[model samples]
Target: MSTLPTLICLHGGFHGPGYWGPLVSLLADKGFRSITPHLLFGGTDKPIQSLEPVIEQVAKLVAEETSKGKDVVMINHSFGSFAGCSAIKGFTSKDPSKLSDQNSGKALGIITISGFFPEHEVSLAAMAAASRTARGAPDPATAPQLPFKPTEEGLLEYDGDPVHSFYNDLPLQEAQKWAAELENMSQFVFATGGGVYAGWMDVPVWYLLCEADNMMELPQQQSYVKKARDSGGDVTTREIDAGHSPMLSRPVEVAKFVQEAVASFSR
Candidate 1:
């Protein structure tokens, strides 16, 4: 019997591993092992102001797991995908000398759920700019900024209501419950952008598109899918009939897709 790859899940901005509970529980029921790390840049008690450290943290985890001879399958959501991809770069670099002992791992596949997958040399900021241009909105540089507030310690908090944006498909009470738990994410992560790791070029990738996602519109998600394919990624896609937070609104479907992705890794 083939052992299933260990699932290393990375949650979206303003979220922690806690956000993956529903999906993880389902995977566990099916006899799969999973680990969801709390990213330093997101819901941690101490805030991380940059992306590099977050990537390094994830890389270390991947290395630790793979060093035990465990194959890994990384799953990422929203902005978490950036850090996940970076970790893959850190691990599978062609130049072995450049990789740290704690940053080496073997990844069997990558699964992105409503996540951003930037093309080479294209940052998330650049993608946002392109999205605005496509929508005929004013240039992002000149557009009015969101109503985010910076703390006394200089951390930016996401003050926008997520109900309409992320939890539109959830029941009213359930949406309110999760919204109350949302944390502030680093604004720096959004302002900075860069190309994804070249490691993704050779990995099998599955993109789970949320068709009704108001947070990342369907058109924008499709653009990322195209970029992934153009960059030589062996891309497979599945569309979910839910909003942005599918793990919450449609856990069973997400779990089934995850199972399928794992099964494809061996074939």
Candidate 2:
């Protein structure tokens, strides 16, 4: 039997690796192995003053897998997409359009679910600011801020109700249970774009656009997809009628989509 590339699952801010349990189990049942790293920026137990640690952790995991002759497919959600870029730098499959010396790394492709895409040298904060301006923020002082509130110890907490923000498609009881698992993420995460490299330009990219997502609205998600495609990145998108946490509300569909990517990689 041909070996499937290992799945490297990266979770978003305010979430731990446990959040990927449902999707991971489903993929495992289909004979695909997965690795979900517990990124430190999302942990409330420690202070994460920068994105360097998160990037280093993911890069180390990818390096280890490639060292063992195991190709990987990176799957990231929400803020995890930004970090994923830096981690897969030297490991991505070469882009035909971009001339580069990195041609032998074992990463086959990338998948982003309701994820952010950063332009080269443009920070997430800068992107957000540009978005605010495009929407005609009449006054900088009166414009709406990011959906996070300052918590103790320089951590940033989600300002919206978790149920409505992430798990609207899930049952009330189940949504509340998952919501409670969220943590106060590092404030430094969104402060800079240190981890935002254009790795997507180096590989085939699949984007799962959550139409019902409250956190990342559909327009914003579509805009990112368009931007990526215009920049000569090989990006394809699949629209799903689910909330931000599709892995919980629609694990079967998510699994099937991932399997589709795996099948394509084998070709």
Candidate 3:
């Protein structure tokens, strides 16, 4: 079997796996394999009340591939990175001599696109609230009211225009098409804090920092990279003049970066 590490693409909140279609096809054309799973937190099912399901689902997918003797590279975008980091525990730093016959593959690397890297026990919601308050928006507890709207069904949807927040670089028609597909994610997702296991602390990491991201401003993204670095993480960052959804607006660029990350496992 060709032993190229599989690419596991994890989409952000409010997005479905379909959003990865363009990038997946591009990677496929280059002889790379990818799996894009729909995280239940972002699904239309009953609202997900905890982060464990998202983490468990991703961990299950990785375990399946690794069991097949195929190493995996996680490509985590936006809120997807939160689950990815927590889910990657125990999958890194494999010892071949101690490997079980059923599972030998290891995690090759992690790639985060405008990812959110919260401290241990810190929820994404708290981080956003603090960030907003620092910028003179509102009290830390009330800052969430500006950017997200709680649906009657208890889910959270982007309050502002998605085109402005997520797809400012795409053409108007394309942007609108994707905007209409946005779903209401579980409000509890941002409330869940990170676990003790954050794979970025141990695995090789590449961060695609979107310079023009309206949703996650460049400074905030830079701060994440810096935080990870300060904690002794091995992170390589590439700045792109694109919006938040580069996989949709700049597929070729995103594909090239993913390819670069996959190639690093060999070097």
Write down the TM-score of every candidate. Answer: 0.87, 0.91, 0.91
Q: Which sequence of candidate numbers ranks them by lDDT, best first? A: 3, 2, 1
Task: Please name the candidate that would achieve the greatest TM-score relative to the true structure.
Answer: 2
Window of ten residues with lowest summed lDDT in model 3: 94-103
**lDDT comparison, 1 vs 2, better candidate:** 2
Backbone clash pairs for candidate 3 read none
Error of 3 at 132 (Å): 6.1
Over the stretch 192-255, how does candidate 1's per-residue lDDT look in tens digits?
6542454556478889999999888898788888877887677899999999999999999999
lDDT of 2 by residue, 54-112 (tens): 88888888877777767789899998987787677777556322213333337788889
lDDT of each: 0.78, 0.82, 0.83
lDDT of 3 at 31: 84
Predicted structure 3: clash tally: 0
RMSD of every candidate to native, in Å, equals: 3.3, 3.0, 2.8
* Candidate 3, position 90, lDDT: 75
Candidate 3 residue-wise lDDT, 125-220, digit = tens: 777778767677866685454577888887987778899999999999999999999988899878877462467876889999999999989998
- Report the error of model 1 at residue 132, Å: 3.9
- What is the Å distance of residue 225 in model 2 from its true position? 0.2
Q: TM-score rank, highest first?
A: 2, 3, 1
Which one wins on lDDT?
3
lDDT (Cα) of model 1:
0.78
